[model samples]
Target chain A: MVNVLIDGLKERISNAIKINQSIGIILPASNYPDLVQALFERINSTPEEAWVYVTVTKPCDNILSQFEFLKDSKNIKFVDCISRAAGINKANDNCIFVESPTMLEKIGLEIINIFKEVDENVKKYLVIDSLTNLIIYNDPDIVTEFFYHIINRTRTKNIHTISLAIEEEELDKYLTRLIYLNDKILKVRDSFI
Target chain B: MPITELSKNELCDTGIEELDVMLGGGIPTGSTVLVVGSSGSGKTTLCMQYLINGAKKGERGVFFTITEPLFKLTKNMEGFEFYDKKLIESGMVNLIDLRIISERLGLDTEKYTVEDASALLDILRDIADELNVKRLVIDSITALCYRLQTPEMIRDFIFKLGSSLAAMKCTTLLTSEVPPRKFQYSQYGIEEFISDGIMFLGDIERKGDLIRTFQLVKMRGAAHSRTKSAMSISTKNGVELAPLLKSRE
Candidate 1:
């Protein structure tokens, strides 16, 4: 497993991964760019781990452009849900395109298939780019239910999963329930290195 | 200038006196207003009141329910003083249940095609023409958007629906589910842009108590208060808008 790039947070994050495979992170929307950069840096450091990045907010091309270094990595897989939803049909050999974020079943099935295809020698990780965007397209209860299923399935498969969400003053009841379902909750601060 | 007088013919009363006052009279005639709020925020009650007000004034009204069944809706409204069963029985107030139609048409999909939108538009037009509906309400448009696959489809549906309603000169109110976000105007965020007016209902926590607040975000051509006012509901009066709260800033 690759350690996060943040100074003090690296050890804590690694410890959380050891204690519990599934983790949920809450942070201000403004901090998402920094977090994503740090996350990709960590993923790039680890050669044996294969990652499936499920993006609900941005298109695969946009995400790839930000972390261009990871584009050539064989261990990185992209599940582009935004492109098909936006009516773009561009095909990429390295990415799987889902129709839309509302098609939770399709996304879940794709994740399962990816897990099956990867060899046992490679460690697997699933990163849901965002839960906030998912809730915007679907009902809160429905999104929460989908997360429950995905988290439980990933845990059973021994595949590490990370879900990200924006912090709100009053946490949504459904999202609060989702946080409880996860093994650990990490609050990402804007000042974190 | 003296308080500008509003022509009674140009405004449609919202059934709530205080709300009408806050709206600079009622909403302009033939305008589409988006009523946005979270669950249990009295969105349905406001829609029901709008239709009941029209029925009481001898104007024909139609309510298209996409989320709940007609029977359950009527049963739940039994406690409201304005919910008269006779209005529906007399055909003055028509309830077109779209839930059954949605199920049959398999409306739940990744994307709602143009054909699907046309089919829905046809049904709405037919009912509007047959009933000569002067007032119209879609219990909730949020549920409809969930079935439609893309943001474009949802936007197209709202545009067509608004245009059609305006052609009939029918005052329409569409309810939208407000997401958990504190600042969201509507579910997909496009509803407020397409609507002629937007009304927001939400609760504020003060000393651990939830105080319901109502605000008129904007009204295209009318003069209205922008301040957030306290709100309450009762069986006798469906919705009441109180004085605006002091600005937190």
Candidate 2:
């Protein structure tokens, strides 16, 4: 599975990128962090291209360290809803730590705000680290509504968005809706189907 | 609702520049304006700013806290530079916890009887009269209504309180809470009818962002913009209003 993911990710993403910019990736719950690193690595982000990472699962520091390419970029920013909510209370320069993951409005505002620093003409990307954790903090309806709103908004702004989600049987409804919301889909594991 | 007949009545400017524009000068003096919103929708901040702004204009403003304590309310206000301590010290702005007033009047009950509600209303009137207050804000009408028990009692209490304060020419703002994304303005469904004006402070989803919104739904005395506008609150500026994004296009 690991070999299949790492090798096929770039080619699969490149093929999909040509057809559609808004893509959803469904990963097995086994090891998405490594899968996430691989996905980010495969994209081969550039300094000129603006990136906004919305992380609900891991700290911004952990996410930064995992992807060494992300470390050197001055253009990349983060919407870290977990750090302060977890009682770390520590602040990062480019990161906007939302009061709680439940404050979806504030998180969306921060994402929109940070992206303001980049020129409108710049190639912008919004990568939601994982929605599986976001669902835990918010109700199902709210979670779905948020993505429905964000994806629609980002499309108008000409921003490429990649939302990562862990495929689980219990959350099949949420996963299915998420897949339908995006223009492209890359399913790493499809046990539910 | 086309209300083309504008108020020739005196205006009590809310001190928010854009809001004043939205309100067509400001709230008509001696009118009871309901500021309704869900939690974190900037209702308290808007109320505090109105009071502070009134104080700046040499109009005595009194804020009665119904749910949160006066200390916590003040502590929250501590960040706002507009909330001056001098206003409190010089007796221009007064922050009174309603519990103390209720206790003093012996009407502090788990659920107020009709007579208790009347007495409480009278007590608030006396406070407004004594202070020579030009602006008044009850931190919430919801919590106060919860103690009123019945809808009839809540209506009676609000109706009396609004008229009495209006008679004193006290431009009042009564904060109200509704669950987020819900259209139910007043929990009792009666405060809207009794109040002279209704200013809804709610959230509107614009691109995954729950933008705080202010809509002057129905102001009986003024011709104002009835559309929902985006709102933001900060320590520097208590409440700032901007035009809302209507759609993605």
Candidate 3:
């Protein structure tokens, strides 16, 4: 049977892909992997949109290895904020690594720089792998405020954003603000594998 | 100044594509660049590649070895594809062991005065002029600077030699090192000041992996990135680069 949650996200993405569009995804703990896969598959098929994936939970290598197809995709870039701090000092050519997740400002600059670098004709998408991971490393209030600016900033550049949050992670304070900043909220309730 | 004005000064490419990108095309012609690194951080490999690349461009080059002999250096170079025997045999690239030069000059290795340093500089300048080379590398300027024994003499000698080489249009790379845990680019903290450019090859110890890194710390008269990149040297690739990952706790 087709996954209802996956179908829901795919259906919602069409309208959410417009300029200034921001979709906040709230995922169930066990269904995180399936929903992200579904989301990227939708993105991968869309030829005009180039993705800039910002990961705070995992390094770029881990993500690229898990999503092996991404290795061949030149349409995507990564902003990994984890690897060297974990004692792994390597990075792929397509990915840019921020020194630490704590370096929030640097992360912001790198994200903007990547967006600036992507082809101008291609539509841009900024996907925060998960925002809760950032709250764990930073103060909730500040991360929310900073992301508020990120959403607005990217919107002006004709870029859409999809910020994910895991319900398994109890970051109630920040999640509430995340919802307010987003134009639409999505709940991925796909049954956990 | 007119908006259309541009510099016509010549530039010397390092032949390392990524490095040349970081250097804003290339180092200015007749510049002195310091290649500082800790031991085993691929300083020699980088310098060797630079000279070999120059030779491929038909611009003759010379390498003055201060830390090792000519024979051993060539033996190590054999492992890298950049090491071309034809260039060395044809005198397109010359490797001169500094120890032999010292022996010829009759200067005491342990103690070298400012006058002795001047004499050494004159001899090197003569050799560089004689060869009519476009590129020159002094592997481990620290070892040679140690002989000078004082900051003033080292500074004086570097300045004099750099000025003289500039006149002859010989782009130079001088190797030096920094101790572990210390931030200074050079051993004596003075070589960095005199050199026209500073490229530091550093290593980070993480989880038993010695991660080599490259940073173009200073490149005068050039637009360069301040970001650090992960670096590696291999027999097939010579020197390769990748993005440096973020650190973890």
Q: What is the TM-score of chain A alone in each candidate?
A: 0.90, 0.88, 0.89
Can you write out model 2's per-residue Cα lDDT over A49-123, one digit (the tens) per residue? 778989998888777777777766687788898887678776677677766676665566667767767898888
lDDT of 1 by residue, B184-218 (tens): 88888787777898998987653233556788998
Model 3, which residues run further than 4 Å from truth? A18-31, A43-128, A134-163, A167-193, B1-8, B11-28, B34-65, B68-123, B130-132, B148-156, B180-185, B196-249
The digit string of per-residue lDDT tens for model 2 on B100-152 reads 87787777556788888778778788888999998999988898888977778
DockQ per candidate: 0.01, 0.04, 0.04
lDDT of model number 3: 0.78
lDDT of 3 by residue, B21-98 (tens): 777678888888999888888898999899999899899999998888888899999989878999999999999987
**DockQ, 0 to 1 scale, candidate 3:** 0.04
Task: Report the number of backbone clashes for model 2.
Answer: 0
The better-scoring model by TM-score among 1 and 2 is 2
Each model's RMSD to truth, in Å?
A: 20.1, 8.4, 7.5
Model 1 interface CAPRI class = incorrect
